[model samples]
Target: MTSADLHTALLRPAVLQILRAAGFGHARPVVIDTATDLAARYFLLLASSTAQNAFNTHNTFVPTIQDVRLALTQAGALVPQMSTAEEGLRDAVEIEGVMVPFEDLRGVQGFVTWAQGPVNKEIRRIAGFGDDANVEEIAAGLDEQEDYLTALKKKHSKTGEESRYQGTILGKDTELQTVSIIGGPAASIAEWTQQSLSTAQTATLPDADEPATPATSGISSAPLTPIESE
Candidate 1:
């Protein structure tokens, strides 16, 4: 066949339909041990609509619990619990039929249940992380949490003066310089009081170049240069 013909055949709906049919094709090496076990294992099946609609319209494998065993047998795996239905659907399979007794159903069920727990745990493990989650994001979040916890612990342990005095050393030095410039510690209270009194007396003079209206309004329009000492 030509390459184009082969490609067209592959893309044909019927061919694609058969290709998508159940991976195990209704056969199984499936082992079930108990009667109470209803956990269903899944295999990939055809993506076609007809194969799906058969679940409702066809017999034996009609997607119901009652029909499952019969369907399984017809599909060619032995199910001891199933009885022969004179008519439904039949297919030739190469494997020999072996029916498991109803008494062994409980053991099969237990195995299925045990299998399901691990399957569910694996699914959760795979899905637990988000699609966008990566090692960098996890590490960065951990680092931020560590910093927050460290800050919290420091605050919890520190008390009184330690807590209140937390400040930059350079800022403290600047504040000290400002305080010395504004009011030197060596300036006694009496001396500082006298200096303020003299300044106030000078402020009372009309010629003192104090605010003209004493209302403290309007600019002096005075030059910024220091006055000459006569």
Candidate 2:
């Protein structure tokens, strides 16, 4: 089997688990494959966008939480933003003797709502995250402040990732050396573009005392000269 097929096969079980947690008792193999592929692509897009944002804004490929948030926002993953001006206009404008209130127009953000729901809690529990229920207080509902995934990861691998995933595709025995593209000076395309633009600007800059020439050559003194007799 191809590498991609093997990767998809590995992801199918996780996707099936999520679906089962979400109340799907049985799903066709095709449906599971489609879901796994979609999930993989979505995550890949998020990672790429987050890395690009980090590199462009901070000059580093390492992404922070804020970079991931921005990437999610750009990808429309964090939806149902505050009502737009157009929606507010609906409050003032009337159609068929009915005016829709801005509050009525507003909808709950699906991502946020899903994250805070029971399904997410169940998923977390299935993934070995600590239960949100407080054993001390039986009456208390699920606590939103718990760091379950972190706790689970720490429990599994207290030392580090290198030890946990040693000799696997997810980890390496030796650190990778930095490599650049052939005939390329910078490590990344973004850095290369910035370097090229800076060099071009420096080369084309006029003397500090001299006024910079206009970019357009079509507009000349001849155009402004008044006709003598014609």
Candidate 3:
């Protein structure tokens, strides 16, 4: 399969995991594909909007938090939209010649609320993590598993096998050595390459004492006799 198809296929597993965490016991293949496509499109839209906003407002392609927020706002992804009455009230209440909506004042309040709410807690619980466990603990658990697997492999391996392949691609340890050309004018590859390049350049150059010959147009310089009418 093509790389794009493979990348899209890889996203399906993450989508399935999210669905499972969100209490979906089973989903059809069509459903999974649709979810993955929607997720990919949403991400692309956010990135495109963020880049445009950054370039238009800040004269830069690099997006900042403000640009991302603006993108989210433009996409209507930010929650807790201000009602007309609320907007009127907010406009009426001005602080130091500046007026800001109550919802706008609570920046990313929806995201923070969702992260701290029951839904996030349930997701964490479903993913085999405690509510209080942070990212560091999760990362450490993965590392511990990897370490255990490595130790198990070494324990099961025959003695001296690892040492025999220690300097090769099959081994874990890396080997370093200097390379030298035995019978070349220069001892090392780098020196030989430099010397060969210098010789080639010298051959192509003209001698300083030699006078330069004018280029020929490949046509006879003598005037041609006019042909008589036949």
True-structure Cα RMSD, model 1: 29.7
lDDT of 1 by residue, 133-204 (tens): 443554566422222223444556656434544463211222333222345733566667778888899988
Weakest ten-residue segment in model 1 by summed lDDT: 32-41
Per-candidate clashes come to 13, 0, 0
lDDT per residue for candidate 2 within 1-230, as digits (tens), equals: 78887777667767876887788998787888889999989888999999999998899999997687778767877655443455576546566899745542223446646665665887756554456554334226355443444344456887886688677564567665555667768877778888999999999987899887767666654468667996
- Ordered by TM-score, highest first, the candidates read 3, 2, 1
Superposition error at 178 for model 2 (Å): 24
Compared with the true structure, model 1 gives a TM-score of 0.19
**Candidate 2: what lDDT?**
0.69
TM-score of each: 0.19, 0.45, 0.61
Worst 10 residues of 2 by lDDT: 100-109
Regions more than 4 Å wrong, model 2: 1-3, 82-113, 133-166, 170-230
Error of 2 at 216 (Å): 57
Any runs in candidate 3 off by more than 4 Å, and if so which?
A: 81-103, 126-129, 135-200, 220-230
Candidate 3 structure quality by residue, lDDT tens digits, 1-230? 78668668666766776788788998788888999999988888999999999999889999998788878877877766553466566644467888655446353787667766787786655554566666455666652222322444476667753775576433567655657989979999888899999999999999999999887665766677898998
What lDDT does candidate 1 reach at residue 162? 48
